[model samples]
Target: MINQLSWKVGGQQGEGIESTGEIFSIALNRLGYYLYGYRHFSSRIKGGHTNNKIRVSTTQTLSVSDDLDILVAFDQETIDVNYKELHDKGIIIADAKFNPQRPEDTNAKLYAVPFTDIATELGTSLMKNMVAVGASCAVLNLDIEVFKDVVQEIFGRKGEQVVQKNMDAIKAGYDYMKEELGDQVGAMQLEKGDGKKRLFMIGNDAIALGALAGGCRFMAAYPITPASEIMEYLIKKLPTVGGTVIQTEDEIAACTMAIGANYGGIRAMTASAGPGLSLKMEAIGLAGITETPVVIVDTQRGGPSTGLPTKQEQSDLMAMIYGTHGEIPKIVMAPSTVEEAFYDAAEAFNLAEEYQCPVILLTDLQLSLGKQTVEPLDYSKVEIRRGKLVTEDLPATDSYFKRYEVTEDGISPRVIPGMKGGIHHVTGVEHDETGKPSESAANRIAQMDKRMRKIKNVRFKTPVHKNVKHEQADLLIVGFNSTRGVIEEAMTRLEQDGIKVNHAHVRLIHPFPTNEMLPLIQSAKKVVVVENNATGQLANIMKMNVGHIDKIKSILKYDGNPFLPHEIHSQCKELF
Candidate 1:
């Protein structure tokens, strides 16, 4: 049996709902508890309702459940809105002033803690979230020392006075919970893991680190919602590693500058969200036509335009596949988790260089902001695949350097601008295999075929779909990007109910793993395709490639929210 606990903190957007959940997660992590957290809020700053959900367990957790184990309502609206979601045996901690009417049959324990009254009495409402944190600890029999340590770690740099006041507020709430909730609270202990571990990191930071590891020396980007964090992280970390991160004036400029840097012989990258990606499409085509090795990371958010800047969605699948005006062969890939993001970024750079093409790392808001702990990366094992640029040992010959020399593997030797006697012309018009402007129909078709063939060649060399529990299941669930963790968790739950299931996560999106995936899907009795996009892009692609649409099931969502394990389990049950 799996033991699960979920907490919801609801209040105005800026009233520390997100901070309260974050602090709880930090404390829980210290206790060796695995956690899954999700946040929801209006796009406004002041009055709209905001909620943060946190799921914690002694065992690993991947998704936040819909049911609440504990509900901390900061205002009357919160109590009114979320009381129905509380479990029958759950607990509700709320302000005393707003007495909510509870059903007679409701089994949830209710405690009125006077949160605002206590904060007002303490002479500052800013400590309200800390009060809630302390109260939660008291009622759950959690270690107060953990909360204290987190406080110090979070606010120690601010000053002594701020720390003291927050601690005082915490103590006040703790005292109140002790007096009211009494010994009914339960104790939770966790088993310690083996000493080998990795520092926790978010997906955006992982992507940035991976790019650095891949020898990306220059990055240019314009600030956009979900993708902005990638730039923020790279800007601070790149300088120390002898790299540069520039904030360009616009998305077009950012992409162009990255292209320029790539042309100058450095591995360069740029990142943006949906709107910015649209703006950079022409430049993306430019990179494609010129066969410059450049990486573009698009951290997708909900949009056709700026539909939802701060929410999660997978609507950009088609955009990444066919965004440019003309037919341009570009490699597109997605990483399923924070750890995968690091490796995928490095691999993306390598693919761009190997194929002399632009590569897109497709990520979404869920992966961009979600946090997780993973095994420490073995940097020694990392292989940097630089392009065919000539270094110290190689010399330019008297014959003119052909930028697009036809080779067996469809990859040409690349010589950058500074290399002596290696200067060559590149243009957007149809070009022959020798990289010159051409209008000949045969040359155009050959050029297009050559570009497409390069990606096809990479499909064989790229990593295949990752399958979990491959040999022991009849039902196969396939997913990509951030849907990986939740689907894995769902498969575990389904197994408990005597339903065997396996999972195949595709990391490379374009020029997909047709050879491996076809056989895997064929082996399964039923195939369930899960994605955050509404149209089930991956499922459709699988059908187009393998010709087995009849056996595949699609579980698609586009609500600007991610699927919980319970939801996926329910869908599987219905299908069975």
Candidate 2:
């Protein structure tokens, strides 16, 4: 019995390709199989090649598998475009309607199944995905009954007959494939899974859930690819917890609205991708100077303009770190895993309030959208820390309150607008202790110094996710966001080939984790900073903050796809 399998389903966009993969992965996740899923789609609503590749294993796995074991194709184009990724013994289950032809050099087996015919005969063509799923079950020797619960949950609302028809469609496809393959019916049977329950979700789902759990009462965002899911999730769940989501007119409005909400003593946030982040830069500067606690989620994608809206890239490192005009204190966090995305998202609110500045929770296209199985979250681990925020009514004062009082720690006392003795000015211009506009040179210097010093003692936990296998490693591999899993898989393969490797994934990008990263860099003979950007932004950041220019190198990929494990392994081998 195989312990792992790589399967994919492909078709035109808006044809239930995503739902197919979701149903399949969800069932496997229920059985305790670890799964990692990635989707390939164009930047359109429909009529383009799209596919979802999922890797299922008994043990936990992070990256997509290097090769395909099975490909379920709806159209000839699906087989044509994705066949090269299949292994020699891989199988292709293509719909008979397309009469799919296998490419000459491809060694994978091709089975022309009547997916559409079976679904149409049962009820509707929309159930073609269910037929394909059944054919996949036959190939993997998985029981057709495994899909019963998921199908019911999906189609149960339609009626009892509809649910029965879908189930029948699955059974028909399974039986037809089973009879055709005879001896090979169980050829690819998988080893039994632990059957333990786990949470299956995308990073955006985790982030939204984390936000709600973290006491975020208001969300203002403009919908954009990848990042829109965060706001959408909040839109549904926030109201149940007495919170709400506002779809603002533009990214600028979204950001400023969030800042306003935060100033009113509510945890609020805005989310956007590259273009939207660009629009929110000026507003971010406002939050920085005004010391208004706000959380901003920057889901990074390929770009300078509206580049690769549905693809992967991590080019926003520098822009996110220092995009707004004039330097002001800001915190940028990059969460590598879905689990970290959750905890970091929740902690972002605390950090913003504690430091009284804007905190940007950074993610890449893959990390933001890729679906995977995650261990249950520990709600107890989430703690809300509102530093120096005065909640109680203070003694009424004749003079304006010192809302921005400079202190040794730089974090000033905060109060809601209606609080007694809290009537003070708030503006974007340079201000003194009372937040009044000021042009005094001394006041400007003091205010700048205070805001800058606020993050000097940031209480962030595990700024760098470290896996130091060796006290002194020959090479150090560094990455952030979705690259963490791929790098770990590559390190395992490199170790098997007799090379020592250590990994460091940056969680905190701004107020860089210099102290923690210094020793890791010093202990390694060489370093490779892998990222999805062509400019090696992360590598340069390491050099600028930690300063080990001689040993540091980069493994970059900016072709609108996340890094595969073998790609990383092959590149690192060249450095040695």
Candidate 3:
């Protein structure tokens, strides 16, 4: 009676894994099952050990389970590296061409299917992935028609002969498995899910979609790992919508171009990982100083150098929040899920245009690379807010536009190029209200004051922290970015043990949600600030908001991996 199952496939890189996992996940999605899929790979192109873990569940899943119910091994290293994580009663399906190391005298069942052999007989060994996928579905009691349909759609371009060969490979693998491993693995399958279809995609895809919905018509970025999907998606869809995605010479050119487009008055953005982000800092400051509205998506990964490019980490909090030279009022935000990634990205444009400052939308490897199920986004919720822009004809006056006008709210009306009576100068250098270079003491004071004074007046929603319990909580766990799923799961386990616990996740990283977070931290008897960084960056941000930050404890992990729910549960258990 397995209500939910965690299935995984391990093989060498460049072995058609991406397509295999994608096909399986899509079929599962059609059957009304939700999947949270994560890819573990190396920085190299091929011949490296890689794996995809797909958590298939009747209920929506956000985190991978600690153990695997089905381990499909393509080679011996796949078995050697992951045997311990297999459930005692789980079954392993190995390709007969490779002798995968089996658990010694263990109850976990192991069956070898001739994946490559069967595929080769059908004219190509490349169909080995299809054979394995078929065996995986057959053992789980899923209908083969679903797999067949996806195969035809994927391989139909090659003509009927090629499609039929793949069909034979799939059917052969399924029949072989059912004939040999009869009720052993099939025991895990339950009734079909509700048949309610849902969209299944990775985080990068959502971010690109969000950019489109956010009215971002221009993008200039140098592709980087884990974050490149956003650029790839935009490259495909942007031009059809009368937009543009320019692959620049480097991050410097990318950021500068985005700033130039924004200055010309269009929603524009550039995305990058750590190294590229470091290169764009100067331009980010330029956007800040010039008060240009632009968004920068930093899909974070292990850092300092070229640290684990394929791994997940929340190590960019301090870097993004405090980056750039001198002083610039900036808004930093982190989205906790795929759904939030879309909306937060849209709001990022709104905030940037409204505040006339650069906005950094932060995401870790987990939230950027991991694929998961998200409810359909309501595009109606997407309302474009182009802030303080003067598009109408201003009575042809001799006065130049005060693009940097000092006001009660620090925001000034912006006009694009060629606007009559709106011609003004703008530069990275310090400037006055009329965009003229100014070095006088009074002007400097007034300009700096105007730029920095908007912190209090920047209007955004309250409770940026997702509070598990709004009332007095026993223990308050504060985390940001990708830690939301695990924290939510951990809180449920803690309450099951009769311990009243509360969790708060901060989505908006800058302007530090002080008024909203003060009461939550104060009410909790014990507060734990959980993050993936070493210094607990969230804790530092909290100290600036609520005094006596030492009252909150820290649970941190920086090992190039995300926190699992059981890991967080164990960490919280120690506090009691």
Candidates' lDDT values, in order?
0.80, 0.93, 0.85
Instruction: Identify the runs in model 1 with alpha carbons over 4 angstroms from their true place.
Output: 1-4, 97-106, 187-198, 393-399, 459-465, 468-473
Q: Model 3: residues >4 Å from true position, as ranges?
A: 462-465
Backbone clashes in each candidate structure, one number apiece?
0, 0, 0
Residues 1-576 of candidate 3: C-alpha lDDT, one tens digit per residue: 567888888889999877778888888888888788888888999989988888988887888888888888899888888777787888888998986568695567788999999899888899998898889867787677887777789889989888888878878888888888756547678556778868787788888999899899999999898899999999999998899999999999999999999989889999999999999999999998898988999999987779888888787877787888889999998888888888888888999888889899899888898888888888998878988888886668777789899988777788888888888888788888989998889988888888888766667654365655647777888888778878888888988877778878887788888877887788888888888878888888888778866688889998887888888888888988
lDDT of 2 by residue, 1-576 (tens): 899999999999999999999989999999889999999999999889999999999999888988999999999999999899999989999999988999998999999999998999987999999888888889888988888898899989999899889889888889888887888987778898899999989999999999998989999999999899999999999999899999999999999999999999999999999999999999999999999999999999989799899999999999998899998899999999899999999999999999999999999989899998899999999999999999898897799889899999999999988998789999999998998999999999999999999998788999999999999998999999999999999999999989999999999999899999999999999999999999999999999988989899999999999999999999999987
Error of 1 at 479 (Å): 1.1
* Winner of 2 and 3 under lDDT: 2
The lDDT, on a scale of 0 to 1, for candidate 2 is 0.93
RMSD of 2: 0.8
- Return the number of clashes found in candidate 3: 0
Q: Provide TM-scores for the models.
A: 0.93, 0.99, 0.97
Q: Best to worst by lDDT, what's the order?
A: 2, 3, 1
**Which candidate number would show the highest TM-score if scored against the true structure?**
2
